[model samples]
Target: MVQRFDLAIVGGSFAGLACARSAALRGLKVVVLDAKPDPGARVRTTGIIVKEASDEFDLPAGLMRKVRGVRLYAPDDRALDLSAPGYFFQATDMPGLMHWMADEAARAGATLVYGKKFESGLEYERGVALGDIHAGFLIGADGARSRVAEAFGLGVNRRFLAGLEIECEPLAAVDGRFLHCFADSKLAPGYIAWMVPGVNATQIGLAASRPQRPDLGGLLRRLKAHFDIRDIRVTSRRSGLIPSGGVVHCLGARRVMLVGDAAGMVSPVTGGGIHTALHFGRRAAMLVADHLGDRGIHPVVAMTREAPRYRAKLLLRRLMDLGPPNALINAALMTAPMRRLAQRLYFHSRGEKSESFEAWCKAFEQEPDAKPHLKLLT
Candidate 1:
């Protein structure tokens, strides 16, 4: 027997789950499918929720740890600390977060089917059929290499950064107040290496453009210069391809649409997509619901108009792909202009002037038990 749904989403991660929850809550019958055995299985992204995302979404406080500053290091080990007064990043328990999102979607009446691989689908005039299920509207919330895009002949991501990460027990020597980042052309090439003090573990990761590979060993070695790692024990590892290209040319067709990484809704420079994925995922649900139920504007046309172009970020990605020399980075990193640019990139327009790293640390030490709160917005 073929089950039917008003909306069907592939992939059970952030985008797909977000869309499913919104659609179902709006009275639409929603079904979500994924190849993973469970929502938390084999997580990919680092799950760093930026200030904007935290403000927009009411995420669980227990699953996240707030990081108020960024400690950026040049190749020669010189560091620059950056922070905005009201802005902070959240390092999450990725698997736990995914499970929570899935539970929320289920609570909102979305049917989630894990361990189901989406092989192929037939899009007819009325709906799209996937195996034994028929959906009025089909959404591809799949990863960077979306089989849906390929099957639909939609634009695919051409440029990519290969990323590798390892999660281990929290390193006591490493300061938990800042997200430690290292810029080294020789080690990370096109991208940067990072150490995030996540909810219960320390996440060490790196990404690099095409020809270059992320060197986890090299990153660990570099970390030794600033912190002790002799007794470190890795618990889990993850690797995946990040889309460094802008949004795809074609986002959707008649009754089918693409959201999240499938549509290349990712920042080319930072390689961050969770924010866009969540934002656009919920947006896609609204558009789909309106178009399918209320005779509104075509979702494809509306989504195309609303999607982010990332023109400047794409240009920056191209430049970063060239990989700047270590000597040049060491020379220019501490300059006033470079510092201002870094501040802008990390904190945007949050605060006019940032407090010194040492001062911030001293203040945080005074309030040892204080924790950052989520500034949720309506």
Candidate 2:
């Protein structure tokens, strides 16, 4: 007997579960599939998100810890601290959050199938067929190396950053309320290093571009030399891939759609995606719901609407990769004016009149002395 569902979701992570719950809430018979038996197992990502994510999504409050500010360190040991009175950088218990989302998805009427991987699928005139399970619409919420994307001929992630992190006992000297970021081109070219304060410990990690040879292990030693954290004890270590190239080449085809890293919805500026994932997950699932209801909301339209912001960020990420991290980090973020510009970009530089991406990019091109660095926009 062939099983069936109104909406089928692959990968039971943040985006997958969010999509499942949204679709289920829309009265769809949603079924979520995952290879992992446990939602929390083999957790990746640092799980640090911006304040806007917490404001936008209804995440579990108990799993979140708010940090006061972010401190950026240049190679010369020049540090720049920036924060608003009310803004926060939140650290989340990622694995626990995933588990909670899975449970919530189940509660919202999504039937979750664990320990089972989705195989190659077939498409019919009405819907796509996945093994014995026929789904009216299919959503690919898998990670960067998305099997669902490959199966549907949606292009794979063109580039990636290798990330490594270690969780350690909190150092007495380092403020537990601050998130620190380091930019040293020699240590981590095309990317940055960070120490995020969690509820129980500190997370130290570095991400480097794929093409460059990075002295990743030496980064920790350097961080210690800079910060005086010689007594910190290690609790755990992790390494994973961070999707680059912003948006994927294709997000949806026919009744098939992709979200999260599978769709390359991560920020090139921060390597953060939880906010983007949740935003798109809800939107994509709603589009699917509308499509099933015979509304003419095409996936192409959704992709078109979402592409501009990711493209702008991709351009910024490319500009950051053009030179040594030291050159840009110190030049762009060290000074007061630069930090003010950074604030605008982070907060809302999207023009006083129109909240368009071109206006946001104008924030860079229009800056004084930006011609030498930000000539691309003109």
- Show how many residue pairs clash in every candidate, following the order shown: 0, 0
Task: Give the CA lDDT, 0 to 100, for residue 72 in model 2.
Answer: 71
lDDT of 2 by residue, 1-378 (tens): 899898899999878988999989989999988998889876778888777888988888788787755667788778766555345667878778889998999999999998989868976777889988899889998887899999989767888877888888867667655678777888878888888888577888888888764565788788777677888799877777778788877777887888888888888866787787888888778888888977757855676476535667788788767645476666666665776655554444422232333344455467776556343222
What TM-score against the true fold does each predicted structure earn? 0.95, 0.86
lDDT of 1 by residue, 224-266 (tens): 8668877889999999999988899899889899999999999
For model 2, the stretches where C-alpha displacement exceeds 4 angstroms are 325-333, 345-378
Judge candidate 1 at residue 260 and give its lDDT. 94
Residue pairs in collision within model 2: none
Models, CA RMSD each: 3.1, 8.9
Query: In candidate 1, which residue ranges exceed 4 Å CA deviation?
Result: 360-378
By TM-score, the best candidate is 1
TM-score of 1: 0.95
